[model samples]
Target: MVRTPLTPEERRRGERLGALLREARGGRSMIEIAASAGISAETLRKIETGRAPTPAFFTVAALAGALGLSMDEILTRCAPEPDAVPLAG
Candidate 1:
């Protein structure tokens, strides 16, 4: 199946998600966190570095669970500002 390309805004949001995850990780080792999340360290690294932005939903759920982040928090932290104008169709 073909995948749609991410928009600039989506890319920015992904970067923000990466940053948030990194900050939440604190001093924990990547391997430890990755294991707890049931994912490989390389996959976590890719997400943290924004190299694999838009990971699968379950992967994100696992990461969020391991990191003690709520879905609401993720949405609040990663979403664009409320006042930002929407892109023209």
Candidate 2:
């Protein structure tokens, strides 16, 4: 099956995630963070620069873990709306 490209919103999400990681990684070198995240320095650089927007889920998860960012925080930060009502239970 053919694969569709990521939407603009998804790309923005990736950029937001990258910014968060950079903030969390303050005072740390890219190599150190990449090593801790189990990814190559170039991969981390791409992600951090939004060059690899919409990176694989596993990659995001690993980076989040290494950067010490909680899922809730990432979601809240990357989400477009902060006050959108949730669906009724």
Candidate 3:
């Protein structure tokens, strides 16, 4: 089945994820990171610039692992909120 095009919110979240990764990857070479993330340098470059909004799961998993970001943190950060809710005890 064909996947629907990403909604505006999804696109924005992807942009957010890209931004976070870019900031966390400061001083690191794109080629190195992308290879470690099991993706192409071009793919990583596009994602970093928000040109590639929707990347594959495994690709994200690799990058997230390398970046020390949990999936929950990525999702929470990518989404906009008036105030962030701290995890409950």
Best TM-score among the predictions, by candidate number:
1
lDDT of 3 by residue, 1-89 (tens): 99798877778878998999898788888888887887889999888888888888878889998777898877778866455678999
The regions of model 3 sitting more than 4 angstroms off are: 1-3, 80-89
Pairs in steric clash, model 3: none
TM-score of each: 0.86, 0.78, 0.77
lDDT by residue (1-89, candidate 1, tens digit) is: 99899987778788988999999999999999999999999999999998888888899889999999998898899997566687999
Task: Give candidate 1 misplaced runs (Cα > 4 Å).
Answer: 83-89
Q: List, residue by residue over 25-64, the lDDT tens digit for candidate 2.
A: 9999999999998999999999889888777878877888
- Worst 10-residue lDDT window for candidate 3 reads 76-85
Question: Arrange candidates by TM-score, highest first: which order?
Answer: 1, 2, 3
Rank by lDDT, highest first.
Answer: 1, 2, 3
Residue 47's C-alpha lDDT in candidate 1?
90
Better of 1 and 3 by lDDT: 1
- Each model's total of backbone clashes: 0, 0, 0
Candidate 1 vs candidate 2, lDDT winner: 1
